[model samples]
Target: MKDSLIQSTDSAYSYPLLIKNLLQAPLVSAPDQEIVYRGDRRFSYREFAERVRRLASALTSLGVKAGDTVAVMDWDSHRYLECFFAVPMIGAVLHTINVRLSPEQILYTIDHAEDDVLLLNSEFLPILDQIRGRIDTVKDYVLLHDDGPVPDSHLTFSGEYESLLAAASTDYLFPDFDENTRATTFYTTGTTGFPKGVYFSHRQLVLHTLGVLAALSTPAVQGRLHRDDVYMPITPMFHVHAWGLPYIATTMGLKQVYPGRYMPDHLLELIDREKVTFSHCVPTILHMLLKSPLSRTIDLSRWKVIIGGAVMTRALCLEAMQLGIDLFTGYGMSETCPILTLAHLKPEMLDESPEVQADIRCKTGLPLPLVDLRVVSDGMENVSRDGRSTGEIVVRAPWLTQGYLKDHKNSEKLWEGGYLHTNDVATIDHQGYVKITDRTKDVIKVAGEWLSSLELEDILLHHPAVGEVAVIGQPDEKWGERPLALVVPKAGATAPVTEKAILLHMRGYADKGLISKQVVLLRVRFVEAIDKTSVGKINKVALREKYLA
Candidate 1:
């Protein structure tokens, strides 16, 4: 009976049927609702749906078939949003190629993905021009342009975005798709040896969308996902599918504001003009906004933000709270559908003091419903939730990728024992709050003791002069390993030479006393907003290679 029930559950509630139903829903329900671009160009759901159908039609005409990969290389724009739905809705896999990577890496992904067609924003033409010869499997280049002469390239199919839609039929039929059919493929930014791909099934994506929606609106967590809510995704679309916001907006009928090129001033303008109620971005973006000149001109009280991609500092969180922004944090990874836990208040604590609420908001958060999170020590022993003992975080969820595309070895590592290993070392309290202590790769080992780089970095960042800091382990014959601090001084500030000055600040903490004995503060040579991944993580792997390796 149990076996039969499990089989029955898998057969019902899939991605293909959901899209058909969503398409039939009231297009004009949010018809006047705008997906703003560049503070000017906009598209409502009704108009957006029409364009999506046309694009689907155009893609089919060009021989795009089910199971083929379609690559989109661009910033956040209306065109990118359309491709997010149209590509998958039509049964082709949408590969959001990371634009921040090197031209060679970009070309490698296109070739590895075996992209059937490449859709690019006109601005990327220069880089594409150099790599166009390297992408062997790509047969067509569909230009997604706003206003400019068509870029000249060897590939023939070049035309304005609107023209292609105008010529194509909006009546193309969307095929019935299986929930297990791969809908999207995004490469891991940490692809060192050879890039590995994680594909999302339609069912997984739909579930993720619903989970994200629930996480945002549950009064305990209070996300800005209400019907009247307007959102601006400061996170790039290529990263974790912009943390699944665009799709969530589609399903929830949100009025979205897209900031092209990610200029600080432009983001502020959009937030003010569109009256945006919600957004998700990294802590660095919040830092920039707090320091940006445009910040003084706009009213931030209307906004609520979810900070991720890195640890959110208490200083920044308090600062945002002072500005009347409802601040929260979430934890997830590229392999686990990106959102597994969020630092949202529970019903019992909703009426707690602001100080208590803020304290709760500091932790990584409770695991979302349907996501089972556990912290394990020595790979197998589950750690107690006393909030003292730390362990590696592992998760199991319906939305997690089955395995890396074509690489069974690492894929096996990713899903060992049916749980996705996060590689993030954290501790959980009795209240179910998770506080990350260190990354498995970033932990500093000294005299058989493990010191958290994340903990050290957090402490150093509190220093007024410290702009950014990364703690890495360096070989030490006496201690076995020692902590090497790479410090990025605050803008227009100089780094201090004495280790005493650094230790003076962290003197009281017991961890600091141990760390102080082995801490070596090294002035960072190149520190311009430390290189981040597409998802806004401080790319510690890259930093370790540059500094420690």
Candidate 2:
């Protein structure tokens, strides 16, 4: 009997859900599909797989071993995609360093992750130079650049990226390991003290990829992602694995375009030149793309965009729809593998009026597959799903980070009551749709009444003249705080837009019982631009420091 059991165990293959397995389908189905970068360099999936193997060989040669963390600082590119697979395939953790962080913050993250190797683009060399001495954990550096010879730098390097790949073997065999092994790590772009590190395992990532793929692929006619769709991510690769969509795209073997460093006009050119179809970005990026003068020249009618990393306003959704572009909202955070819900319109609602559709498209959206999402009160009881009662958004998913890296206290707080706290105040309807009202910190209180800054911003965005807006809470003597609005008027707005006009627009909604009449205490200002976070989110922390402090 013991011999029979041992024979059965040896005969059955126990397949582990490692990051390397994501490439299997793509390799067979679309081996020749082109992965383009910057409308310049291009390679087929057949060659891309070779590059992944070569990269693994290179890293292994440079002393990278299982469990070592390999950090990379680069813009969106094919090389980064190779790093995405190769590092994790070899059982090493990939730390996607956010290059936008301050020099001091960057140093802190490197040390915190204990990164063993660094893959850096030449453009950000100056940043490393400023804090290189302080980055004690990194043992070797690999440089990446677009053209010309490598520039002279003081820091010693292992080798240039392309050179290393060219010299390495393309026949490296990747061994399988436990699925719970750490796969990736990166710090959050928090406005608080220090950016906290977050991590995911091989098992969590595989499940997240499958869950998101199922969600994107099942949408009937609205927001489906198929093998034929051309994938481009406007979201930074260093940001939460570019919301973990690259893995999905690769798994489906979709043609992908990676714009190196984002330039609005250049991005428009790439979309037009490459015939790109599906993409995702923060609201700021989408706004910038619309604002580009080249927007009028390009044919954007074929594009489908997923807006995330921030709340997308109704005005922006309307504008995109008017241009015949399909736009929707995706909701998640840096701690949750960065995707939870997508606001894909149901087929029945596709026949609705454009205005009504815009309202639906701008919602935070329904939770994705395997996402156990809830809005709960202080005691952890689920809130009523009447769409009017609001509470904190909590979630339990297969891929949520177990905890903040090295942060035990905050991790305990994040996972209190067996759910990850999102710190977002929101409501859910009977249809299981989540509509976020505001960040708990950003909510305004007046006369002992609560107000949602996001709701106020959404209302003001309906104004014809308001191009972009941010609402924040300002301290008040009579009330704890009142909402303040900073508006950016569109170039050549059809009608005159002023503080009074904006106030009247919001007040109309308040009078209709859509919002709190406490907005009567609201104030407005016209600013050239609003401050943004390192990852292009509206920097409420900076705004509060500048205006309210």
Candidate 3:
């Protein structure tokens, strides 16, 4: 390669790609845009910037400085949005604690991340009390309350959130730093072991924000996000920066609504009251909302939702479309700054039948800009671009995390060939669409042939009485391993679901050549519910242990 280095004048400004720089255009273009909380409280982007400065001053008074770790444990709210910008803008790494995690994992993550200052919501006070003495790194605490004054708790707060913000000056300036400095870190909610920390730099987050904004704001028929669109996030802000949409929203100066805690009816009411136009979430949350009685009475025609964290079932997609809701899929994980692909329908495909559209929508998606996604074999060679053939997904992207924090051994495994290994098995078709068939550990090998558990689950979801389903591998004396499915029947199913009934349903698909004939050996179990991870993904590792062990 030719040497491309160039020199600049001595006085030239090397503008770094810092998170604070993302504010410049929005402050001018949309200074008056509103950021609302739970459909009621509201503030302008002008005030938001001032609050960010005030927060920086407050955190500094509490001894937070450049390179310190500031942790937050709160639900999705305007307060979380302030932290998203303020904490990083002041040259500190923000750790968004996954409050849904078990108390033990919560403690482990807090200590593991070496949190220096913790700003906590009152609802999480009990949890803090449970492990107050055990925490080692948190030197100061700030209370965050929504309804009233801070309640009684064992942990002492250095100050309350709003009080500090109101008392501080808006003149506190954020200093420039290296764009590669770590901006955010959060733990992955894996099913097997203690969560591993993933960190992203200021450069990575800015790039992710711009890339996702470019993808979502681009011209499209159904799911494009525009300035006129009102945005809400069903995904928690703590999880991968709410898949990094908050930053993108702030960058574009879009009207934002934060639903503090995810409650179905409450979300529906907010959607109706605020006329929410764009949002994203996991499949489980969407399913719960569609099942709610209030959702039936509301007008969802103006809404568009992007589904991730788990596969979006064809049934759910069709149901949303019938209600005039524009729903699609997005793909990524905590380590990737959480945006890799989106399943927006192509222009021509927009005129196709609803069934064909849902078929496309349920596929993983087309990779986002700057995302080099591939399905490769064990040797790191690319697999054929045929929809039928499957291999592991490996990718190269500007925003992908360099490695797991403080863990040397597993980090190398994650980037074995300089490409981040996703451990997900997928296939890319001629049109460049990527469809994940199954996780490497989740794929079932039956009768010497590999079978996709995701495929089995998607097919079973079509059953009239089936509500939710997960497929796992079970040992069979003859075949070595067979597919066993756990099914959750619809709430008001007219007919009781039996093992034989579901097995017969699987046989129907096998007969149609839609699946492997080995599905003939499938077994079924009815359950009240499927187990999920902390972030609401199906926990197959737990399922295999519970059902097979």
Best by TM-score: 3
Q: For candidate 3, list the clashing residue pairs, or say none.
A: none
**RMSD for each of the candidates:** 3.1, 2.6, 1.0
Task: Give all TM-scores, in the order shown.
Answer: 0.92, 0.97, 0.99
lDDT of each: 0.80, 0.92, 0.92
Per residue, candidate 1 scores C-alpha lDDT tens digits across 1-549 of 456544557658544533445544436466767788887898878888888999998889889999899999888988888888899988899999989877888888888888999888887888888876677898888887776586676666655567788999989878786777888899888635546788888888888887877877776345546888888899899988898888887777788888888988878888888898889989988888888877877899878888888888777777777777888898887787789988987778768776677767778898888998999987578899899899999898888999998888999998888778888999999988998988888888888877888777777777777777777777778887777777767785666534566666655454546444444432234355565665567777777777666
Residue 340's lDDT in candidate 1:
91
Which stretches of candidate 1 lie above 4 Å from their native place?
1-28, 150-152, 347-358, 492-499, 508-529
* Clashes per model (N, Cα, C within 3 A): 1, 0, 0
Least accurate 10 contiguous residues by lDDT in model 2: 1-10
Residue 49, model 2: lDDT of 99
Rank order (by TM-score, best first): 3, 2, 1
Task: Give the poorly placed runs of model 2, Cα more than 4 Å off.
Answer: 1-8, 494-496
Model 2 over residues 199-294: C-alpha lDDT tens digits? 999999999999999999998888889888999999999999999989999999999999999999989999999999999999989989998888
Q: Write the per-residue lDDT of candidate 3 for residues 1-549, one digit (tens) a residue.
A: 899889999999999999999988889999999999988799999999999999999999988999999999999999999999999999999999999998889999989999999999999998988887999999999988989676788888899899999999889988898999999999999687899999999999999999999999885667899989899999999899999999998999899999999999999999999989999999999999999999889999999999999988888899889999999999999989999999988999999999999999999999999999989988888888988788899999999999999999989999997999999999999999999999998888887899999989988998889999999999888998899989999879999888888888889889999899999888889899999998899998899999998
Q: What 10-residue stretch in candidate 1 is worst by lDDT?
A: 517-526
Distance from true position, residue 245, model 2, in Å? Answer: 1.0
